[model samples]
Target: MTTVHERARPAAEVLEWGRATVDPAMREAVGALPDPVRHIAGYHFGWWDATGQPSEPTGKALRPTLTLLACQAVGGDVEAAVPAAVAVELVHDFSLLHDDVMDGDRTRRHRPTAWTVFGTGPAILTGDVLLTLAVELVAAAGPHARILTSAVLDLLGGQNADTSFEQRDDVTLSECVAMAVGKTGALLRVSCTLGALAGGATPDQVARLGLFGEHLGLAFQHVDDLLGIWGDPAATGKPVHSDLLNRKKSLPVVAALTSGTPAGDELASFYFAQPEFDPARAAALVEQAGGRDWSRERAAQLLRQALDTLNVAAPDTTATGELTALARMAVDRTH
Candidate 1:
């Protein structure tokens, strides 16, 4: 059992611990894949370069960390949640592989995307394989499988809406919020739910934890959208004003588009125009139209709500503190 003092470890420490606990199993799971698919998956995971040589690792492992922590929060053994953590991480990477292809993105984690390095069909097939692996990992656990499948369906629906928004000019803030909920919140919610279930949480406890994850997930999206526009390339591993360059109908962009301000109007004009419309100027107009500040404030509000829900969930003291710290980190991060 983790002592109170040990449980009170800092958020970064907790993340590292979660990574160490989950990575071996993750690697083992990937090892079972066919050589070609495994190579592409490994490259996408930053486990190796395209040549199959070991490389520096990437990803924050936030979802899996949340899974482990949520299990501990409910007074369950963290080891029992390892499979769940691995499954969630696989699903996440699967989505990323497909997303890069659909978004026409050429880079990820400061490296060429799988679709760019390999062929698009190969990258997409690799994503399918990873998703199938995720399902196989939990196939024997009926409730767990159901939970994961539900979340995946929601995620796919969200991705569909997101892609559709690119060709649209009339996306509302509410619609954008709904999309973020499905795309980001659904998986995060499932991470906590699966963890709590593995830890033997009461139904009420699972519900409360799920709510916490949902709110935090939405908050995470707000911060991510902000980073997409303004974050440093070195930190974010993406170009400056990347979202603006894509004319993405992100939360902030949608907010600015619907703000009823003159800056918003100018932004709509600039944003919907042809390519090469000056991403820096588009970013400035988003800020001018109050999108940036609104997103910042919304993120803070959601963080508070998430913490408050977590407090009511009757989690262990150590879990509460660590979860609080992680929640804050999720919103406060620049990348």
Candidate 2:
């Protein structure tokens, strides 16, 4: 495992460069949308508030970081990969905008969600525009337009599976993993592949980077489940037990549900009960059923796979250490 250096300045600088690439392209693209849609997009990304005042505290821009790092790891000029990085971040934000609407989430980054403030219609339309712009950003670059569209379809399908899981207690762990691969993994996976292609990587390197992204995405989602249930509100920017309150049937919950333990049976009862919330007992039950521990171990394993794949593809690069360090930091993040 790469040491997570305590020095924050260097990582911040890399992330700032990543954001610079993403923000300008995003703004220019959103500017092409109708005024109402543009405002929704801006507000969602925390460029402004509902009333158009400037704001901070947007998302972490993780996808673009992965994009840019993959480019550099493959010995490509970071500047050449800027357009693809922007495209990756745009697609990610588009997904988030729609996800908030579909989940009826009222807040994000400690601020009101775009759908809540501007209404679902505008928020959804903004997502459509962002998706279109994502395509346009990568069009001139000429790598994976069809692949990007397919990823969107995968995202939609994954979201559908997630929503459908709410009504069915029969969800297997395999099914849950597959749904996650489609919903979250596909986007991250392709971001790496596209970045490598932009960097003039060969087909083999592209596949390796894509695999690394896939594993990283899985680890990320599993860690997200942990945060949803137990992360500090200040760090996570959401209320504790948010997943429990929502009964989200996330990866860990599904793992516990299918564990076939006595605790699993008890956990199922709580999930099916009306007025659904018993945070303390729910936490205990999941722990007793081994969901929490299982998820933690699985996340660690997936992260290892991501790093191993990265090492295989790009044995030496000026940016390899940064890529490894960032990948590890992503899984370790509280949020």
Q: Each prediction's Cα RMSD?
A: 2.1, 2.7
TM-score of each candidate?
Answer: 0.95, 0.93
Distance from true location, Cα of 130 in model 1, Å = 0.9
Native-vs-model 1 lDDT?
0.90
User: Which one is best on TM-score?
Assistant: 1
Q: Write the per-residue lDDT of candidate 2 for residues 238-277, one digit (tens) a residue.
A: 7778788888889999998899999999889878676756
Per-residue lDDT of candidate 1, residues 1-335 (tens digit): 97554658787887888889999999999988887899999999999999989998788888999988888889989988999999999999999999999878888878899999999999999999999888878775445798899999998998989989988899999999999999999999989988888889999989999999999999999999999999998888788998898788999999999999999999988678776788888999999999999999999999999988988885557877888888888899978
List candidate 2 segments past 4 Å from native: 1-10
The superposed Cα distance between candidate 2 and the true structure at residue 326, in angstroms, equals: 1.3
lDDT of 2 at 240: 78
Clashing pairs in 2: none
Stretches > 4 Å off in candidate 1:
1-7
